[model samples]
Target: MTHLPRRDIIALGLMTFALFIGAGNIIFPPIIAQQAGEQIWLAAAGFLITAVGLPVITIMALSRMQGSIENISRPLGHVTSLLFTVVCYLSVGPLFATPRTATISYEIGFSSYFGTSSSHLFIYSALYFFVVAWVSLYPNKLLDSVGHILAPLKIVLLAILGLSAVIVPRELFAPAIGHYIDHPVSEGFISGYLTMDTLGALVFGIVIVQAIQSRGVSDPKLITKYAVIASLISGVGLTLLYVSLFKLGMLSHDIAPNAVNGAVILHAYVQHVFGNLGGLLLSSLIFLACMVTAIGLTCSCAEYFSQLTKISYKLLVIVLIIFSFLISNLGLTKLITVSVPVLSTIYPPSIVIIILSFFWTFWNKPQHVVIPVTIVAFIFGVIDGFKVAGFSKLLPDFIQHLPLSEQNLAWLIPSFSALIICIIIDRYND
Candidate 1:
């Protein structure tokens, strides 16, 4: 059994880190910190739980299963397996996360110059995805293209931005507002969902496995071990990155108190300290950050679909990238609006499956425990999606009263209840 050399392992870790730390991840921490103000620590910690913690757990779990998300769902049933796989791939791939990368890069790199709604948005997005498709056309070079070149460039640019923040500063401290004043942790945990890291993890796991296997690490245990280490490396790198951004956000309120969102917070700070040149530098960093992630996701999605169908991965990349290009025309805000309900519906069940996959080995007749709870979670998740879209009048008031419903955690109580009941049924059946 051959082990990957130290350099290969480190390269893989860096590549994994780079894959996870996309432009969207770069935006959230500062904005959250800007809101949390002096309480940024607690809020950021809570945010890290889902953002960093879940993604790490997700990767680790995937590594244990040799990186096949389909394997994790194999116990559920064929229809369930295929349905979840397709939904997970489509939702995170072309339909939502993938296109948003192009839109966001356009927003950061070109929006100010061209205006977000300018005729140039389409042109910019077309160029962006074109590059994404090109880079992703050769999946085998991912370790070098992403791990060595892109990751290092992104980290250097971010380090410069972070160091500059330390030297120039925004303001000493910003005050906590709204929910951050009281339930900083809870709100932060909830807000972490917006990062979408958890959802991305399920899809990314397979990609990580492929990358590892490409490195000549054929042992399953070694693959799992290396993957877990890489996820930790990714988590640690993101945490450091987020801390720097959050620190900047804590100081930024005095300079740009009117900042509405993360992108605004980021742009305001970079432009303030660096000026026009700084803004341009920031634009490059944003583009590189988004581009690498788009490449990884495109490759992963194409790989999955290619396996599912008789189509080749290369052809699938072209098809998916073109489809993603079309979706990019929908614009970022519209894409986000559509994604929220879809995410709300799917995320609950996705989280449940992750938990079940982690613990199902200890259960007797694990299918009894997995299927019923997943079905219940799925049903409730859809209803919750309707509620989020102003169709709440269709749901019973009782559901609205579920514990933590006010915090949008309404699925917790019922899901847990279903899990317990299913376990009992499994035991009875046994």
Candidate 2:
């Protein structure tokens, strides 16, 4: 069995971390800390659970199943699992995430220098996806190209930002506001969940496994072990990054008291502290972070679709790149408006499937238990999506009163109920 040398393992871990640290992951923590204020740590604890914890758990789940979403979802049956896998891929691929990477990287990294006109965005995305396509077309070299090269560059930029957050002077902590005033943990959990890293993990799991295999490590046991190690390393890096961003946000209250979003807070803080150099630093950081993530996503999506449709991998890469470039031109605001609801719908079910996969062996009929629970989770997930899309009034009054419904977690209790009921049936029927 070929083993990855120590240096290779670290690079692989760095690559995994880079894949998870896209635009949303970086922006979210600061805003979360701003709102949590004096209760920042309390809220951070919750944020880390979903943002850092859940994604790592997801990687672990995929590791045992050889990093295939199709394999992990096998208990859902063939057709259903295929549908679920397709949705996950599209959600994290061209439909939303992949495109958003371009828009955000442009907005945060280049818009100030190049302007935010449609043509400007189109040109940026054109060049952006061009690079993504170039790297993605050669999946066999990802370990060397992405793991060794791009990941390290991204980490260096991130470290500079993280260090600045600690060393810079800033305002006093603001008071907790809104839900964070009383329900800090839960509110933070929701914020972290909305980052969509868990879903990203589902898509990126295969990429991580392949990166390991690229190092000539073909042993199944060694692959799983390395995958879990990579996840742990990524998890630690994410936790540290989030904490630093949270600190930056907490101290930014004075400079950006009326900040509407994390981007506003980040912009103000960086310019205020770093002077003229801040813009360059932030832009470079965002670009590297988004670029690495985009490459990973593009590679993963093309790999999956090529296998599924029996199309040529090179052709799929070109198609996905062109599709993502067009979608990104819709601009970030509209992309976000459309994506949030769809993400809301998918997250609960994804969470359900990922968490419950580990316990399936205990059930006499794992399919009976897993399938119903997943279905119930998906049904409520759609309701949450509707609520997010501003169609709450269209829902019944009772939905508003469900446990944790206000937190967009109405699926939780129902999914648990279905799981227990199915387990009982499995026990008795068996």
lDDT of 1: 0.84
- Runs of candidate 1 exceeding 4 Å displacement: 166-171
Q: Candidate 1: which pairs clash? A: 171-251
Q: Across residues 34-100, which tens digit of lDDT does each residue of candidate 1 receive?
A: 8898888999888988888988899998899977778888778888889998998899899998999
Which candidate leads in lDDT?
A: 2
Model 1: ten consecutive residues of lowest lDDT: 165-174
Q: Tens digits of per-residue lDDT for model 2 on 1-430?
A: 9999999899989999999998788888888888888989999998899999999999999999888999999999999899999999999999999999999999988899999899999988999889989899999899889888999988998888888888876647778899999999989999999999999999999999989888788999999999999999999999889988988897778888857888888888889878899889889889888988888888889889888999998999899889999899999999999999999999998998999889988888888888888899999999999999999999999998999998898898999989889888999998
Model 2 ranges off by over 4 Å: 169-171
**lDDT value, residue 420 of candidate 2:** 80
